[model samples]
Target: MQSDLTNMQPPCGQIQRRTFLSDLGYGATGMALSMLLNREGSGQAASTSSGAATQGPHFTPRAKSVIWIFLSGGYSQMETFDPKPELNKYGGKTYADTVYPDPFQDPRYQERARSVVQVKREHDKIMPMQVGFRKQGESGIEITDWWPHLATCVDDISFVRSMYTTDNDHAAEFQIHHGRHKLDQKQPVIGSWLSYGLGSLNQNLPEYVFLGSYTDTRVKENFSPDYLGPKYMGVEFSLDPNNPLPFGARPQTVLEKEQANQYALINELNRISSVEYPHDEKLRARINSYELAFRMQRSVPEALNLDTETKETQRLYGIDENETSSYGKRLLAARRLAERGVRFTQVYLSGYGEWDSHQKLKENHTRSCKRVDKPVAGLLKDLKRRGMLDDTVVVFCTEFGRTPAVETRGSTKMPSGRDHHPHGFTIWFAGAGVKRGYVHGATDELGFHAVESPHYVTDIHATLYHLLGLDPTRLDIPGRKRLEIDRGKPILDILS
Candidate 1:
């Protein structure tokens, strides 16, 4: 008898009952398409590093996975990790009131910002910090009162102040990973670099995974591998157990055993084609993707199902709470992915522009921090308890930071919020090879500039590469030359 999938009725097209893929995956039609796609600089060529390339990882690696937690809109450096008590000391004053040099007054500001001047440049008043901070743990790292849960994890984290980026717009979102101004050039994101350079541990899951809401879906450059090719890009998965892989489910009519047989048959056919096209890396990757997708049909669901986790474990992740539930689930899933050997998992919190507190920084940040604080702390604690901290790296960062000056977009001086400050901000790293309970670099008293050992965005990339035992410089392709800036120096001081 014909399988239910084969006999199933269709709504608009034959997709519901479609069976043949050999025509597209093989044959003369496919060969010509492959030739056009893989032409030099076309970014469709076979990977330089074979699947999970490690002909001896550059050095003995410290971390096996990275959980990159990115807050969608910029969070305030003054309000968050870099507590600028000076903002409270001299509130409602212009930059001129301070003895420091005007950051924007420098001739370099104009060129670096690409002419996107700070909103109300000179006249923008300094807004007082919205929250009070206290030292957390023995590290004496001062964190704002808004993040009690995260405060506990501070000793496990190393706060990296003096972090800056040039793109004044949300495009910094793209710049943070690409190592180039979003408007200027396109390059592979950090995840893609890792995915390309290192071999994955699990065959069932993607090496790079993206989980977050995007303000503009197109700016997902964080997961895109422009030159490394589409195969290196991140694969986004749904959190829902029933549809975690979304549209990757097995056919309704076919039983699991029958579906497995069908997959075997298709793989045999693809293998026959693989023999005909022995040099076609794209074809090999395609077949591997099919095999992976089948495996994911079982793996992803099992991984995402919360019912399997104990009630206490669920509560620890704040999965039982309403306000924290959504973000908690994402972090928990990220931890699960890392545990399963996914190399790089990028998790985004809140909706697009959710953290951009242009006005009322206190109200906006209080709620925003509450949503993620517990969940993040729980992930850290869980990982530590499981001994994963010794091998897993955790990162928390945003696009840039809110301005030290009050953001009076419409000339409302005391609107009580800050604008985007690309001059200086903060990010933190924990676990793996990174220094713990440490503070590296600093901004000025007003948190205006990265006064102490400032690092460009790419430095974070370099640090991650070092931890993963991949050298960005050595991973270059033959025809494509990477700029020196793209191979940022690793922040050695932050490493253990």
Candidate 2:
């Protein structure tokens, strides 16, 4: 008894924008439009208003895109990329007992590490390396035995062993991306700033994309665009090709042509409304999203479709195996997104706090490394062979490195795991603009602090911005004056 148009009718009231769209036989289109409007409602318009950089690049760019791989939970620097034979040599001894100076007594200890709860940490017992390490690749960089596959590609990577942060807790996760402690005023993350500065190479796809799921809702702040606006925030996507864009599919009742016509009519209506309210920035932004959403319905799914990939390529990403499959798919998807001109893609290779090994450190790190090592190596190898390495930068990092001493919580000095150590850690970069097979900076003998050329987290951001040919100092909003710490100096020594 009802026609297709009848089902879309509102229940006789003053029609809101959603209800008005629904009344016009908009189905999936209405859902997409409403969501886009709501998402843009909370913030300012994007710096890239019409598919162009509001402020163009400052100079020639070294990288066209970036793929940031984040490993949640802290990983041990000594056990991973930075090998410290001193740990094994000084095992079971306090700093005073060893030949090296006592890190606890060093003035830099209080200057660099900031405890959130104002509680002083005292872990005097040294925890020896849980895993053995050996020189790898042509560079002979010492890496833990756990990352055998990544070891093969060591010559292509540049390891920065002296990265440090101020936050000593899990909140360092956000600090790593935003370059600010949890106690300070939040700013846009690295990806958000990139999106704000560069806009999109592919207008149909989001300029900044985030792959993989997060166990904690608060982690969204790691990809947020606080003052720069919602348009710069990273858009979350699933690896599923059939439904990569949730709530973005057309209804069965709506034909493809009908949807197109509906979008056209909506665009016309919004433009007409703009004439009535010239100051309505949200309305103008909504008009822009309609065209993007319509184009994304096809582009996003195609970009995520793994079925088009060959079995050999699938195996390269370790998708053929179960242990590495989850992270493998996400990394592979990140590559696909990058190839399609996505400016920045953030891939969460681990769940929130997955690497937090407070006890049984050996068991946790061994299994955790197995889950990511091969796939990460595969990504590097794949990028190199495809010639994408020359224009894409890959970053592998975690929130912080584990403490060197055995955790002494509740007087359990013999606990197998290390505590969170924000005083120093290790992170690595590869491909495009960075020096190859190079190791920059260093931690102390016991890996207690970044003793040589220590870099705060924002320096990493500054480096990325510089690689993209943007000056971090010049990329700022008018009213919001940034602190000097927010605009860090680029690490020029590591640049090619």
Candidate 3:
């Protein structure tokens, strides 16, 4: 003031000394801050960002999506689709004296061994399927009495009774999802691989979706995207039967317009920041996710709204009944997801009480079957009727098959349960290019092993990819090399 800086305004051509210093300081500070923030954001982006997207298989795929129905805890082959007459004759006997040594000798195997409820020694006493088997459709493929509705669609299914695996315990369950046994070395799950191979067709919806009830808390190593990272992992919305996904709808207080404004503002800020830091892929992904989330809020609600479905369709899916309602809803939802171009949809059979019928085999298996059979049949029929069957592949599989012999360890003399048998099992395929109404491969007389045309879980995975027009052998990650087991061949005979 005394120097006339305020009054004179530093003359016409000259700037005030303090003013110049202040402007310079501000510019330096702004530049430094910008640089610091950019560095920090860049570092974060490098750590969190994913690699470039890859292309899918070469040929035009028959199936645009896959709906895998995972019957957890080993579904018994004898009791379900593959009825063994031998079990009926040799029920309640011992095969311990046979040449085959017990595979469950390690300390890690203690859980299954202790949990087993054996009715006889050696667990090879063939337990006849409590449910009757009848040939269905023109193909006359055999199915259980419990699954009358599913039987109607047998002509559209291709049964594989010769599937085999290495792991005999629950640990082996990993193979069902990842196509490998050793748990230490994590591999990309089938869904993850698919997601990685084929980016989402609908940007609003995730490529892979897991629909089920989370009543069973026993965490298995299977249901995750092992080495593929979080990007490829499937998103789980709701695991409750009453409400399958969480965070679907917003509160009434949060109006749609307000939500839109909030998202817009966030996205604008992200975009502005992204320009200052072009290498920030994480920021870009975050912006993309926000838009996707908003779209999902609208899309998912519409997809889940069963009110739009006719009453007859609702009844078909068993939405009216309590027992079948939960799974039925899931199956219906799966069909909807497939129709919407979601790539992979995995539906878990809900309710606790394992299919691992170590105590009451007949009672448990029958109840489980009742809960699943109708809804499953309804799903297949609905798909076929909607004309989605030709382009959608539906796979029905379990962790493994039960022991051919009765497990009589911790119970009364009369064997009541089956032990874990990963040696051989049955899985069914339908839709897409799969040959309809055909049975491929066979198990031994006692259903102990795959004596003819033994196929591994990887083969099934490869065949699925092949049907989807993906070459499983060619799917590669830049850093992590694949193993031979991962390079499985397509099950050609089953493919039409």
**Model 3 Cα lDDT, one tens digit per residue, 1-496:** 2453245566788885435533432332222222112212222113423333345655788788999888878888877878887666666544454334333342322322322232233454556657789889999888888887788889999899988776666656666788766644668678877876777778768788777765545433444666565556666656343343354444456677876776676666666665555665555554455556567767777776777789898789888899898888889988888888889998876543368787678888888888888899899989999989899999998878888777767747766778777777899999999999999988776677775777878887888788877776556655666787765777788889
What digit string (tens of lDDT, one per residue) describes model 1 on residues 294-349?
Answer: 67778888877767888888898899999999898999999999999998999976
What tens-digit string does per-residue lDDT give for candidate 2 at 369-453? 9999988999999999999999999999998998899987866655899888988899999989989999999999999889999
Better of 2 and 3 by lDDT: 2
Instruction: Tell me which residue pairs clash in candidate 2.
Output: none
| Runs in model 3 lying further than 4 Å from the true structure | 1-52, 96-121, 216-222, 239-245
lDDT of 2 at 208: 88
Q: Pick by lDDT: which candidate is best?
A: 2
* C-alpha lDDT of all candidate models, in order: 0.78, 0.84, 0.70
What TM-score quantifies how close candidate 1 is to the native fold?
0.89
**Which scores higher on TM-score, 2 or 3?**
2
lDDT of 3: 0.70
Identify the leading candidate in terms of TM-score.
2
The local lDDT score (0 to 100) that residue 460 gets in candidate 3 is: 77
